[model samples]
Target: MHARIADRGRLRKVSTRLVHEHQVIAVDALTVSDMVKNHRLARAISDASWRERRGMLKNILAAGPAES
Candidate 1:
């Protein structure tokens, strides 16, 4: 569940730093459905964890108006 407590509370600190570094990026994430169709890249893409982390970032941005 996305609402489930974040992993050991580290996500927030890391997410915050990432936001600062990227400056409120509006990433165009790949469609995992289509991505998973390719066997060659599926494993690599899933291992990267970009989708999950991106989701977390979205949640943060949704909750607050981030600014420098």
Candidate 2:
């Protein structure tokens, strides 16, 4: 859904959608930065946008939209 938009916007949209649509999203609790320090996985990790995605997930789960 983010072919044309920036990564930041893409992450936001995905997280928002998942939070609203799904009741049970499983996010890993690993430390992305530390794990990405591995040379073998650095490129793959960077391309996946894991850090930003994780942050978005945590934010939405912790404090999602207000109830009507």
Candidate 3:
């Protein structure tokens, strides 16, 4: 639980900095659901938290004023 919380905090910080530093952000379109269906890769993919990072980026971008 503590680790998850820390990870989330770090992700938020990093995402905010990334959005503020760049005028545009681009990410590959990934089929996460399908990729997760593969048992061998599921754990690794989930641990990476790609969806959470993307969501954070979107929320930060939507919240206005990226400039510091």
> Among these predicted structures, which one has the highest TM-score?
3
Model 2, clash count? 0
Q: Which stretches of candidate 3 lie above 4 Å from their native place?
A: 66-68
Error of 1 at 11 (Å): 5.0
- lDDT value for candidate 1? 0.69
Query: Candidate 2's residue-wise lDDT over 1-68, tens digit each?
Result: 46736768878888889888888988777877897899999889778977678888888778857720
Once superposed on the true structure, which residue ranges of model 2 sit more than 4 Å away at CA?
1-5, 31-41
- Supply the global lDDT for candidate 2: 0.79
Model 3, residue 44: what's the lDDT? 98
Output the lDDT of residue 3, model 2: 70
User: Tens digits of per-residue lDDT for model 3 on 1-68?
Assistant: 99999999999999999988899899788988999999998999988899899999988888877442
Least lDDT summed over 10 consecutive residues: which range in candidate 2? 59-68
Error of 3 at 50 (Å): 1.1
TM of each candidate vs. truth: 0.58, 0.64, 0.80
For candidate 1, lDDT tens digit of each residue in 1-68? Answer: 44445452566667767776776576785788888899998898876667667877877777764541
TM-score between model 1 and native = 0.58
The alpha-carbon lDDT assigned to residue 23 of candidate 2 equals 83
Predictions: Cα RMSD each: 4.6, 4.0, 2.0
